[model samples]
Target: MTFRPLLALLMALSVTVTASAQSAADLGASKPRKESTLPLLPTASEADAALISAHLLTRFHYDAQPLDDAMSQKIYTLYFKLLDGEKVFFTQQDMAKFAQDKDKFGNAIWNKDLSAPFDVFNQYVLRAIDRMNYARGLLKQGFDFNTNDTYNVDRKNADWPKDQAELNDLWRKRTMNDWLRLKLAGKSDDEIRKTLDKRYAGYIDRVKQLDSEDAFQTFMTAYANSTDPHTDYLGPREAENFDIQMKLSLEGIGAVLQARDDYTQIRELVPAGPASKSGKVHVGDLVLGVGQGATGPIVDVVGWRLDDVVNLIRGKKDTTVRLEIVPADQGQDGKHEMISLVRQKVAIEEQAAKKKVIEVTDGGVTRKIGVIELPMFYSDFGARSEGDKNFKSATRDVAKLLGELKAEGVQGVVMDLRNNGGGSLYEANELTGLFIDQGPVVQVRDARGQVQVQGDDDPGMAWSGPLAVLVNRGTASASEIFSAAIQDYSRGLVIGTPTFGKGTVQTLIDLDRFASDPTTKPNYGALKMTVQEFFRINGGSTQLRGVTPDISYPNNGDEKDFGESTYDNALPWTQIAPADYKPVADMKAYLTQLDQLHDARGAKSPAWQLMLDELAQYKKLSDRTTISLNFAQRETERKQLDALQADFRARHKAIDGADSAQADADAQLDDGLNPSERSLKTELKEQADAKKAPDPQLQETAHILFDAVGLINANPKLAAEVLPYGGKQGNSASMAAVAGATPLPTQNSAGQSGGASRAPAAASSSGH
Candidate 1:
């Protein structure tokens, strides 16, 4: 209830502002001409918005860093990186020209002078057009992949081309690499040539479409992000999209998309959405083409804008949309697969918290453990305000599930917060209340250096048994709060990898509200600024260094490639005075024994070994920045990669005793089924898939929990100390305290912004 007013303030602030596969040869035959246009310039309104945003960020942002000449240089560098990050478009001469005004960016932004940024962007557009045109020409020359020449794939740190000739040579090698990838995928030389030609044409067309708003947004975003990664300037269209994402209801295939290089990549799938139900889509997968209906032509989509690609995938309810995607693990081998899905409104119920039971046996004794897979910290604010007693919320639903698990006589529980990008801050507080007695859950520090302790005032424990909180790199914001609270209280064993370090809290500011001219007509976009940072009850902040699990699993991803630490301007982790609360029990004493058992079991698990091997292979592949252009060499490498993948699959099948082919068949929906029957089939398929691939990390967590249960049972004193209400688990007095309490007031849907990991311009969810 303490957070309700803050939530209300945020809601009030928000109220103001608001495909196709083309076949290679036939599809690419015609060249799409680029429209000649004047240089894009910032409009009067955008300039005003930029000035207003600069004022707010400098005066109110949590970082509290002054925007002077030094800050100007940061914005300048960030702008160039965003414009031509790959270093394939601009030359060293272009950089030299841009460097002349590098120290003037801050002053220009403050003074509302937009000419410098616009001029730089115009130059970038021209360079991009020239590069694409040169690339198109190379397609006709036909590549000779027999040479041992290599192409560098990672050019972020590479030097810019010194001249036009050097730039041309870079394009030549890039064109050859593209051809080699398609050739490896079994496409003929003619098809590859046509595809490359069309791709470059699209690239040029996209560049030609850039307008004043796009330029303004990019420049302003660079200015904002220089303060902090989470801070951003959202244009009108983008502000609307952010609202939709928060609502979590869309009319597309239910996938969150982000642009990476020339491809639109799947960031995450909405639960129970068409894409997730189809089971063919996955995170990190690159979408290549989109088609309408089952038989529509698959239009080439490479080099298209993120929003354009999203529009292509979204359609009316029940309409079929097809996608051609390169699997995430395939890594530019050029292999692709087509998947068809029906468009529908993503159901909120599908994204709600769900429960299942996994049985863990150790020393011939089996223990039933409840696993609650929470996708996000969600709540229906609208339903709650209307006095709907059963309004949905993470804490409410999880409470009911805990009662059910209790009835089933489970011994322990594993809270699976993996990939939960975070949501409602109120729900996070109440959810922590479910596991611990009344106490501070997290501390919030404002830009003014004022600290506020947010905690659950509610008096009962939902579950007092041995518990383990499972997390990964995707867990962030509110998720980090709950995990850190549990760890601080020693109420549960935090398992899995370090979380996504997003401790900063952001709020949307309507720029139009602050404009001095009333006649401006509200076209000024909003600024999402960081106003606060989160600290755990133990006084440590979860900013750049997320909660490190008490027991860490082997991580497969590079820490540098993911999480808040990836941002150069991210706020540093800090601390505050520790909150006054007693930990249920110190988990450190039992960690050594538990770890020994875990390592021993993993040593004997073929699946675990396989995961390690795959991680090693991934590391090896990730380290390579160049690829040989020799056709024979590339063919042999491709064969070796294929053989390795085949071996991994075969070993996995042997371990799980599930045929991959059969699993695929089970996932497909039969066209003859009625609507109700189709729904039933989908549900059955989801269950079958879950059974087919049991989560190794989760299974291991369950084992760890069982081990904790055993340890507690062996030590009566420890058991007594661990139990809630002084050895009385879920006592009648605690239950009565909660039963008579007033219902929690509903908070605004935008109380705490989620997923600080991405900039608004880069991420989008398709549909309304």
Candidate 2:
């Protein structure tokens, strides 16, 4: 129901290797003394919004100068596209008013005066609401369900006249779907109409529940964003609530709340926390009834907004917020599981570094390999800077884990960086240092074109066993930087599909910090500015092109599903002059062989075929997003896709030996199948698992290392043939450092390079 495990779509943040940093100090700091980038808070400030916003514009700097007219207009379009709502969404009247009073907005947006920020923010919120209403209408009419990232293709219709046919038709269908849902749920047409009172009466009931407090609360975010991506404004109650949320300790069932249609949905339930511990309050479970204590009757709150529900749930320590939970899987008939729980703070520990040892026995030689998972590199600056010490960073924990693994005689290390969306830049630099001795790691060029190279300060390789880095479309930002460097330096094998193409950097500045803090409830906003681009040491930009085709391996990632290119306004990829570095053997010729081997295995594997089939089905459904209209048609299409997915999942489960005989018998009876099925049947796979000998990607990396070992063994002969001018100078200096930096000969418990772990479950659960 919820996926905090690895949300690649979480707000953007910078990775390591950029010179244009948020702090005044140089960008090369391995372990920063303080997190100077985020806006300092008097209280605990390492919250979601700050992290989310800072994640995006973390490396960029903000300038006071106004944007170019062209840029402003483009941003304007984007702003509307992203902000417009689908129910009670923005309407035609909203755009006309804005156009008529452009001067009013212009002054509010750009006036140098201090009052301008708050005034502009107020106006922005008002305008946003109007647009939001229209957007909601579009959603109700069955238009593309868009969010901040996935803006509807048809939303840019404000410039032209939009009638009810073109404008609200989509929203009407969505409303009809809701209407259908009510009808299916056993609500008679007469009963629903009588209960609703008017066509938009259902909307009105939700509107009153929305209220000024909630709307203003959202407005404050827009106001806070005007300054930078870190500083934020919170009303008296919200500030306290936010503080509780960040500490991972929360009262009232420890659930993240949000408005979903007419109900307040539980977004995230802290695993092992109060709600999760109870096991009664599952994610997506709705809290429609809250009682004071054990005996209080549960109140009907189906139509209540989020804040009201939260208020009802709030209580003193040990006091119960008797929650009437509607189990996620059930619709209106969802079981009411009353959970009586004490209000207590729950600490969030999910982000802590995790370590696992994979066993590989190769050629009868057994070796244990270590794998470490780090979700984010976070630092509590205020706590550490005050000399409290013991500040947490991914590098320190990983280094410690490496030492522990080395002590256990682990041979190779695979840095499982897939879905590592990135965090503290300081961790990226320090983490890079763990792998290699002091050398240039990455270069950063700012908007002004000032370039700076961030290098590794340490001079010793940390467990340099056969290193392999696992990455995919979700491995982004700092994760990308570290992986690219490892690949560039020939320090490790780059496995998995192409990474998330996010190479830009942003910086957050607190509007409140830049202005006077009003004694009478000061409001704060943050501005996230994209200022610089991160680059590889060899001058390759890790932007849209992202980390390039490294040892080709197959993954479930479809080329067009999701990536950097998914967005319309993403920056393009380009290259600069290559850095002065030793040349590594080209893997192109070997990659071809590896690709063929992988294709052979995947083609025959039913598990892989099922996944490929699912993709085909989703693609077909997505394609239907265009030209597909009407509530009935859309519902039918959705039901078909969902059914196909369910069938595919059942097929996959059957392959896993669940009702195996029955499933297999069913499959054998069917002869006319798609090309994908035929392909699977044709290629007999000896390698459904990576442990099989035919796995070429592993062979290539191993062969590269093996060849280097052979070179080291025949050093004298190599020097004689490859370099005639040798001995004390020239060619002696030309000798490659292969002997010094080869990855450790690690083995899994199975003891083979091929036996190294494949992150199938991790990849599947994390999607890409």
Candidate 3:
């Protein structure tokens, strides 16, 4: 089945308003005239839209349940989390007052009564303004960094303060932490004071700028997200942005951005976009400032709205946008780097699947292995609909690359899907077809309990020689589908971490279609809701559990911080009757031996050892929830981290230098090429140089595949048992027996009998 273009769901809901005649006493405020800002009130159109949205969510959503007291509590809790996730603004007393109508949120949405949510949001505005003012006041007094104290970095589960005094204490430490970060970054006391004064004032200004639309959107989104994290309500402006993104019309740095606390964080880089090609920014990096052109003044965006930050970053094609970002690996250490990228439309050619060959030497034998790196499952649906057979697609590009690799005489191929967040459900099926002759690839079950099996009807195999599919936590949806299919069919060994467990499907529904009044037709925005769930051909749903690899590798990222499993209300893993399909080959019996060979190599390889050590250091940093307030201790920690990063860079440089020398030697053999061919080779070399150092994971995978090929060639019966198209029996002098090679102790790098355990690092969200 064809799928619609996937849009990153934006939850840009906040509280704001204009002044009304209602007195502070009438509105249940403790006092009045603290600020000249007015309160926001819901409009009639918003109320009507909310009621209609509630009906659609309750009636049509996959796994929809009654919007009763239980759902109301979920909405209530989520709403507060949305408003004050750090638990700094709202006090215990405020929560107590809000709890009285906590169970009434569901009924309020159903009956078009927005007063309860509106009143709660208005109260939040007052509390937030008070805190900002308090923060500004503390900057004047300065901080004593010598104090032996600690500040909790993550307060998502922290309790609300009891009263104003308790809130003030929290803000005191918060302000001190802020000041300490700036000081450590080499800013003078005067600069710190000035910067903070502007930041806090900016926060208050942004809060005051929220209108009724913002409040309603937040409330409605809270209700939608209570059912599932993927279900979201987009306001009119957000809906328009989504359309622009889908059409690939927005000219910008091509980074998906989101608001985290007071900072705008990079969620994902659009594949082949300016940011992705720049090789500087990364997911989870926080944007601290933005500038225009090559020499524009940097504008501090610490407390700016996400939309405002996005606007500042976007520019005409060929123009440059500069970003000041704190790297994700560095946490909040206050050190940031500047990156400048030329805004450009995403190039489809850059995103197409690419092929390269690597040589693996094992047990005195050398073998050629081909690697196909697919960034995403893209297909030009518009072109295809217009009967353009030459339209680019993941499957078509991969098919051509496979033919080229076969011509290059590679013995095995690794389908690298790491960091591929999935697109084009149709491409996923067709891509799977390129592996096996023809069979069912995936199963989909709608909300009505009807299952439809999607498969390859074409009877042809592309390159069926020894195969391996590489994946990681960033692999989701269609990527998961393709990986799971290969594993289920016993066609290849899946290596790397577990796939991102995003098995559900969402479709955008324009709320304007449900409008009874013509005047409000297109003003209601849209709702992206979960309409179906994906199931594997083996009867298991790739929901919370995802797809476990045949041979697991070490992953530094924390699973809890990313993937569909991170959503508290995510759909449960389930099973259905297995689809009718035949297995091509079984690799289960060979996994133990492969794992042993991999572990032996990993223990001896310096690159592999360095990677493990780096992961350990990163995990240690990521696991910390609190940071030292003592200036001396913090400085020491920062110095140690800097040293570690320097060591890693130096080691990588050494390795790259060796690789570059070999690459240069290979380039010397291209003298006989035509002018166009030479130019293409030069272009490819430049692209390769722009990428980060060679991936240790890809090299290790090639080693494993080489071992498998040797084993198949040495043991004639093994090929018939594990090879789909019988055995290609005939061993050359180079194809030696892998079993004859002495095996090292089976202990893995982490000293476990199995593979390495998943480590803690930044998690990549789906479709970002």
Per-residue C-alpha lDDT of model 1 across residues 1-768, encoded as one tens digit per residue:
000111122122211111111111222312221243668777788888988888898888888778899999999888877777778887888788779999998778778889999998888778878888988887887978778799998886899899778888888998888888778878787977877786677567667756676678778878887887778888865665554445444466877676554667776677788888888998768888888788988888776655556656756677788899999888656699999988886645556789998887778988778899888876655455676565556776787777677666677889999988777666777788788766888888888899988786655566767789999998888899999999999888999999888887777677889878777665688887778887899999888888999999988767767788887777787888999888876777678889998999899988788778878988888878898989999889888887777677767678766575345344432222212222323544656675666468998998898887787767866665554544464544222222222222212112211221211221111110
Best by lDDT: 1
User: Which stretch of 10 consecutive residues in model 3 shows the poorest summed lDDT?
Assistant: 16-25
lDDT value, residue 20 of candidate 2: 9
lDDT for each residue of candidate 3 in 612-691, tens digit (9 for 90 to 100): 98788868877888988999998897777666666666666566665653443343222322222223235446446547
For model 2, the stretches where C-alpha displacement exceeds 4 angstroms are 1-72, 85-97, 102-104, 111-161, 165-168, 177-347, 356-371, 403-411, 517-521, 552-596, 626-647, 659-768
Cα lDDT of model 2 by residue, 73-169, tens digit: 4334433333342213444665664454333322323332223222322444444334335544443333232221112333233343354354454
Listed in order, each prediction's TM-score against the native is 0.76, 0.60, 0.73
Per candidate, the number of residue pairs that clash is 8, 68, 6
The lDDT values for all models are 0.72, 0.47, 0.71
lDDT of 1 at 163: 78
Model 3 earns a TM-score of: 0.73
Pairs with backbone N, CA or C atoms under 3 Å apart (clashes), candidate 1: 19-290, 19-299, 20-290, 20-298, 20-299, 21-298, 21-299, 22-298
Cand. 1 Cα-lDDT: 0.72
Candidate 1: Cα lDDT at 320: 84
Q: Per-residue error at 692 for model 2, in Å?
A: 24
**Model 1: residue 108 alpha-carbon error in angstroms:** 3.1
Segments of candidate 1 deviating more than 4 angstroms: 1-37, 250-351, 362-364, 379-392, 407-409, 517-521, 661-694, 713-715, 729-768
